[model samples]
Target: MSFSALPKIGMGTFRLKGNDARDAVKSALSLGYRHIDTAQAYENEAEVGDGIVSSGIPRREIFLTTKVWHDKLRASDLINSLHDSLTRLKTDHVDLALIHWPSPNDEVPMSEYLGALRDAQREGLATHIGISNFTCSQMDQAKDILGDTPIFTNQVEVHPFLNNRKVIEHARQLGIPVTGYMPLAVGKVMEDDTLIRIGAEHNASAAQIALAWTISKGVTPIPSSTRPKHQKDNLDALKIRLSKEEIAAIDQLDRNERIANPEFAPRWD
Candidate 1:
């Protein structure tokens, strides 16, 4: 998909499950969210699918993304897992499919998994393929493995508190876009004095300021919220333009406090 065709802000469904996941996705769609993010690891694809169907919106209007977990990075496992994801999503194809993370200890070579992901795209299971939680070196290896096939976007934990500069810089250098999950910093941004002050100037909430900062840097922010009001507030960040100074202030908040690093995660750059 063309970069312009992708929405800069999307609704995230990480950790949201069962009726809550379903209701949240439904509410997000009703609140004007055209992009929905979920993953096999989230274990809420069925609920997410139900919510999407219940939105009363045509499937063509939504941009859907799903990921294959780390353990399932083998060629056969990756392909089979995504097919299951498609079934659970109640869609024939996903706009984007990603390798949830690099294989732990390089157990499965990058070529194998990314090659399988490319194969899935050719099979019409995914319109595009990408990776997540990959460090700079891994991004290079992915490009080498995929050759001309594009890496759609790198979805990672990025927020005002953990700016993820290395990953973001490498993605930019490779001409790939980024999707910032946990853009609200898991409710931590709301307690920041600087973000609060910036929000006050824009008459928005601290979370909005954080989301706006992510957007200002050309990164798409998928902020998860179960509340319709909070979902609307997040989408509204698309409209709150931050000045250069405001953006700089938010940039300074990055202390490289990473989140979502599992024991098996690759060594970060």
Candidate 2:
């Protein structure tokens, strides 16, 4: 998908569950968020779908995306799991579908699963196809396997605390836009002294500063919140335009602190 096709800011539904997820999604949509992100592994697709439906917005107006988990990377398994995700989401198709993670230790060849994702696209299950949490090397392999196919975006953790510069740069070189998950660093941004100071300059909250900083770096930041007020606060981040010096200050905050590391995660770029 073209970079212009994707929303610059999205509402993430990662750790949200049940009514929380439902209400958050509904509130986000009601508050004017057009991009809604979830995952099969998040176990909240049903509620997320309910929220979307309850918001009274037409499905066609929403840019919806969901990821197939790493455990289901086997060709048939990936396709089947995505089918299940669509069912839970109460949608016939998603705007984008992604591999949640590369196969642990290369248990499944990139060709098998990526080909299946491409096949899913061909089957009209997802309008766009991409990957999440994939490193530079794995992305290279995927590109080689998928050949000329386009990658919509690479969703990865990219906060000021974990700039993920290498992944961001490599992805840029390959022309895959980066969508940052946990752009607020899971609430840590609220306590950062630099962010706090910057927030004061614009009369914005620290969270907004973090999102603006990430946006200034050409990364789309999807920050999730269970509360309506916080969701609105995140949406307001788009209004913030950081100065070059402010962006550099946030850039200096990166210390290789990755918050989403999992046992099965690939060696990062």
Candidate 3:
């Protein structure tokens, strides 16, 4: 999919559930968020679906994405899991579907699961397919395994604290875009003096600065917030443009601190 059509900032629905998830998504859509991201592991697809429907937004107007969990990487399991996700999400087909993570301990080969994802696309269960939490090497392996099939985006944890330049560089080299989660560093960015100082100049919040930094790198940042004001603040980030000095200052803050690492995580490149 072209980056222009894909939302530069999406509403992430991780850890949000029940009324909170439903209400947040509804409000986000009302506030002009056309892209919504959720995962099978989040276990709130049903609520998310409810929010989308409740918002009175046509299904075609929203770009919905859901991921398959690591445990369900087997071909049959992957396919069945997506069917269940679709049912819960109340969508005939998601705009994008991803392998949530690489199989734990190599329990399932990359080719097997990726092929199954392709099969899902062929079945029209998802319009596009991609992988998440995959390292540079795994990205290459995925591209090779899928042959001519396009890998849409690699969803991973990216924030000012964990800039993830190497993976971003690699994905850029491949002409693949990235989806950055935790763009605010789980609220840590708000405390950074550098970000605060930069935001002061633009009348923006530190969170907005961090988010703008992510977008400036050409990565989509999916920051979630239940409060309408914060949600609006996140969406407003798309308007904040950072200068080379500010971006370089933020880049110097990377500590390589990863927040989404699991036992199954591929070795970082």
TM-score per candidate, chains pooled: 0.97, 0.98, 0.97
| Regions of model 1 farther than 4 Å from truth | 1-5
Considering every candidate listed, which one attains the maximal lDDT?
A: 2
Residues 94-155 of candidate 2: C-alpha lDDT, one tens digit per residue: 99999999899999988999999999999999999999999998888888988889998999
lDDT head-to-head 1 vs 2, winner: 2
Tens-digit lDDT track of model 3 for 68-94: 998898999999999999999998899
Model 3, global lDDT: 0.92
Per-model clash counts, in order, read 0, 0, 0
- Across 1-269, the per-residue lDDT of candidate 1 in tens digits comes to 33344587999999998999999999999999999999999999999999999999999889999999998989999989988999999999999998998899999988889989999999999988899998888888888888899889988889999999888988999988999998988899999999999999999999999999999888999999999999999999999999999999999998888778889988977
lDDT (Cα atoms) of all candidates against the true structure: 0.91, 0.92, 0.92
**By how many angstroms RMSD does model 2 differ from the true structure?**
1.4
In model 2, what lDDT does residue 36 have? 98
Pairs that collide in candidate 2 are: none
Q: Which window of 10 residues has the lowest lDDT sum in candidate 2?
A: 1-10
Q: Which model, 2 or 3, shows the larger lDDT?
A: 2
C-alpha positional error of residue 129 in candidate 1 after TM-score superposition, expressed in Å: 0.6
The RMSD of every model to the true structure, in order and in angstroms, is 1.3, 1.4, 1.4
